[model samples]
Target: MAQSSSKRIFLCNSCGNEYFKWHGQCPACSEWDTLSEFHPPKSRRKSNGAPARKTTKLHTITHKKDRKRTSSGINEVDRVLGGGLLPGSMILLGGQPGIGKSTIAIQIVAGCGKSALYVSAEESEDQLALRAERLGINTKNLHVSGENEIMNVLEQVSVVQPSLLVIDSIQTVYNEDLDSLPGSVSQIRDCGQQLLNACKQKGFTVIVIGHVTKIGTIAGPKMLEHMVDTVLYLEGDERYDHRILRSVKNRFGATNEVGVFHMTSAGLEEVTNPSELFLAERTANTAGTAILPTMEGTRPILVEVQALVSKANFGTPQRNTNGVDSRRLSMLLAVLEKRLGNFMGMNDVFVNLVGGLKIQDPAADLSIISAVASSSKDNVIADGTVLVGEVGLTGEVRSVARIDQRLQEAAALGFKIAIIPKGNMKNVKSFKGLKIHGVKSVREAFQIIF
Candidate 1:
């Protein structure tokens, strides 16, 4: 039997939808000019020989009691990866351009103290070396290659048999057999799958750096995320020096773990105590400012929540927020008005999370309310006081998870007092150096803050 000729197909880069021909707009994602031509993989020919029968009994299979983990020399990254990275795991790490994705990848290889191969599709080996040198990474066991072709990289991988593999920017790599340009939908999917298969078979850890679209999402087929063992995202704005490595998906460990890093001239530096860094410049006795302890996965972080309420300069008082959702702010403001009888509809309110960090945890609700109320009432919350609680729509303060962790973090940071939900008071038996004030309602919290 002869092999059939490969047929051409059009693929939507936005949604990975395949079509017979290119169209002006992708019907799947409704994106314009995202369709590109590519040749799909040819079907395998039927084999006359019988397929091999393989079976393994559960009792006969050997089970390893503990997973093999290697430290990546970066404490923050390791924490985000559920303590350490396991062998034979394929991790896809994505970030915006110049957001230290490559820096952290190299740091991991250098810090592991193992034989490693760095494959760069976007830059040359010399450029990688220069970056390593600047970061003070001098590992003789670490090797660098600048090949983009998946087959050639696999050949090198087989020859080197390195314990760790780093693929810089997977979008730039492609398979020669795939009739598509690099960074296209087909190229990213194919290259990622091939690399993942090779790494799993070879019993090595592969960290693939990926590019993000303008909308701050991983660029490529959504299936690309499903094919990997873990998906890590390096999040932070370029205008700020702090970067957060968050684990959105982890097969071997818990997700939502965050590792904090600071961008420095030497490279990305691990921040052991992010709470201190976030509150370092916080001014004392500020009317619109309130300190809040929020949990990021297992770690507790203390950050300042600030709100400014002023008379509206024009009609339709603007309600603005940065780092906190505007809708959530509106709800909190409405609660304050309805419960505390503080009229905010006629005033312009602005809420900001200091240090440019976004907070999704509902525990921050009470802190935001406190700050906004303090600004509105022209009163300053007592210094060295921390707040943590969730505000319900019915004017009651709800208890948040891990109250002990938040209290411990506040105590460690020299916070003397805490305003928390009354429901959490039952969970705390003793916490040294911190005073807890429990409030059943948002009105009670406001009375205490004032």
Candidate 2:
């Protein structure tokens, strides 16, 4: 067969738009300096007498009854994957460098009790072996390869006939036919497409490790994410010891589900009870600190919301936050000032969610306001008390979802009292040794807390 000719083109990394010539800014997305050189694969000519493709009816397609999921031998991982790993599905695991992306991949494939092939384009085989030793993973069923060429990697996959294949990074691998260098826009897209096709044809699960951009998205064409069956992001703060494996997209499972793990010398360890792990070091009766039961997927986690209110020395008061949105904090402050006559205008306010866990649950609104109020008044909320409600602009406490689950988690953790929205009182069930108080407004909540 004769080699097909290829043409050089420019592609926008942001929008995946092709251009015949380079431009300073992409005309499609208007992003500057995102255009990179690309060598697209030449299209093959079709014969004029080619046969028409046959389509299968959806109802006529047979479904497998005995097809069961294979567990990765880790409960937390299985939870995020919606039970276990599905055959022939491609998973994209992306995170910052040294955030345990590779370590977790090795552990998963090693524990799956199946023949696996791990191809590391970025690291040599010896380096991977040393890291595996550090992780204490020993398995004869796992095969290691240091090939960077996509064709050779696929060839090895064919020879090994493994049930699982891991590409240490999609960025480092390149196709020999493409003129673009590794990690370039064209190389990543072309290499990824080939890998996807191989995975589907060979009936093996593939986990592709990808590097994240400075803004924290997977550093590749947006199409890379769309091409995969699942997209997961490993996220954590550098100062914290815990890492969160969150699923942003899943075809076989639920999205936005999270699995918590603690970083250790032995690699990532599953955090069974994240609520207790997050609240292990709480100081009782501390002002500017409140507990909120927020749900991560179907699991409810109790995290501390801390606020600090101090006099502003400068002209403009600084509003700083960690693990909380600054705009939402400002809105809560405005509500406190307007409704309850509390003056936070001249105070430098800071709010933080403990354990480096970031939550967007509106149920945290009441807890944040309570913590701010407690700090401003120098009053401590009673110990063993939890808050779960959303604060509206009109100062009314709004109901949140899954109030029963949140309260049950609080009760299980020995919380004596729960301050919830009055609207949720109709659905509240009595828990032994736990008292529930329903408040209609922020003022009423303040009265109960202080």
- Give model 1's TM-score versus the native structure: 0.91
Q: List the residue pairs that clash in candidate 2.
A: none
Candidate with top lDDT is 2
- Give the lowest summed-lDDT range of ten residues in model 1: 44-53
Cα error, candidate 1, residue 261 (Å): 1.4
Off by over 4 Å in 1: 1-38, 42-62
Instruction: Provide the RMSD of all predictions against the true structure, rounded to 1 decimal.
Output: 3.6, 3.6
* Candidate achieving the largest TM-score: 2
Write one digit per residue (lDDT tens) for candidate 2, span 1-450.
122224677888888888888999999989999898887656532222235557878656467564578899889999999998888899999999999999999999988989999999888888998888999987689899989988888878878999889998999998877767899889898888888877776578999999999999999888789899999999998998999999999998988889999999999999999999999998788899999999887789999999999999999999999998999999999999999999988999999999999888899999999999999999999999999899999999998999999999999999999999999999889887789999999999999989
Cα TM-score per model = 0.91, 0.93
TM-score, model 2 to reference? 0.93
